[model samples]
Target chain A: QKEVEQDPGPLSVPEGAIVSLNCTYSNSAFQYFMWYRQYSRKGPELLMYTYSSGNKEDGRFTAQVDKSSKYISLFIRDSQPSDSATYLCAMTHLRGGFKTIFGAGTRLFVKA
Target chain B: EPEVTQTPSHQVTQMGQEVILRCVPISNHLYFYWYRQILGQKVEFLVSFYNNEISEKSEIFDDQFSVERPDGSNFTLKIRSTKLEDSAMYFCASTLSQGPPLHFGNGTRLTVT
Candidate 1:
């Protein structure tokens, strides 16, 4: 199985709508979860990162991790056109060294 | 905020030629990495560097692929003999420490013809 899996959604949402992006992993060892936003051909930009389970909030972005279920999610509230980008879920184990696995990003289009 | 910066936003070369992609990571960061992304695929890890040595590398990093921090401020990936399959966006990333949430550069689009 792929270490990390995510739905490659071209998810379209109206401005101010809430957006939820998620990913699941088979590795029980994953401890650090992160969300990265990529605009077109640009490189991935770190959006939010969480070290433990539950939720970590930064402004309109909230990142959640469930180590028990090996699941993670990123919730964007009151989304704006600027949020229209590909969102990729990434995670790594603190003990696994520097290799962080990335998910196939979900494309988001926030219509203004 | 200081950010990683990659040079020559785009590079095109012959399949058998050697190509070097360069990057300047955040001044205060100590760990550096190289990643690749095919046109429609997910970003994949290539290799990671710290303290002037390779700390970790994925299967994709083979004999043909090599990374070096030639100087204190520059990190580079050199493909010994590029193949058509080498065409992709090569990103250079770094973090203050060895872990998740890497800060990435805009990337260099390599086209091997």
Candidate 2:
């Protein structure tokens, strides 16, 4: 099984709509979860980060992790055209060193 | 806001030719990594460098691939003999510490024909 799995959705949503992106992992040892946004031909940019099994909010972005279910999610509120990008979920174990696993990004298109 | 920077935003090379992708990571960051994303595929971790040594690497980082922190500020990934499958967007990233959010460069899009 892949360590991390995510739906590669070309999800289309109207501007101002809420967006939810998710990923699931099979590794029970993962402790750090992150969300990265990548624009076409650009590198991945860190959008949100969360440690352990809790929720962390920053501005319109919120990241949540559930260690029990090995799931993580990113919620974008009041989405804008600027939010139209590929969202990738990443996770790593606290003691796994520098090897972080990334998911196949979900392509989101926020229509203006 | 300091950010990682990569050179040669795009590269095209013939199979069997050597290629080197360069990066200048955030000055204060200590950990650096190399990742690649093939077209329509997920981003995959290639290797990590710390303290001027390779801390970890994935299976994809084979003998044909190597990394070097030649200087205090510059890090690079060198592929001895490139293959068509080597075509992808190579990204350089760095973090202040373990478990910290990684700051990535704009990436070098490599096309091996």
Best by DockQ: 2
Per-residue lDDT for B19 in model 1?
96
Q: State what share of the real interface contacts each candidate retains.
A: 0.76, 0.76
Predictions in order: lDDT: 0.93, 0.93
| Candidate 1 docking DockQ | 0.76
Candidate 1 wrong stretches, greater than 4 Å? none
Model 2 docking grade: medium
Q: What is the lDDT of residue B2 in candidate 1?
A: 92
Q: First chain TM-score in every candidate?
A: 0.96, 0.96
Provide the lDDT at B75 for model 2.
97
TM per candidate: 0.98, 0.97
Q: What tens digits encode model 1's per-residue C-alpha lDDT throughout B1-113? A: 89899988999999899999999999989989999999999999999888888888999999999988888899999999999999999999999987766999999999999
Per-residue lDDT for B14-85 in model 2, tens only?
Answer: 999999999999999999999999999999999998898888899999999999999999999999999999
A7-112 in candidate 2: lDDT tens per residue? 9999999999999999999989887788999999999998878878999999999889989888898999999999999999998875645688999999999999
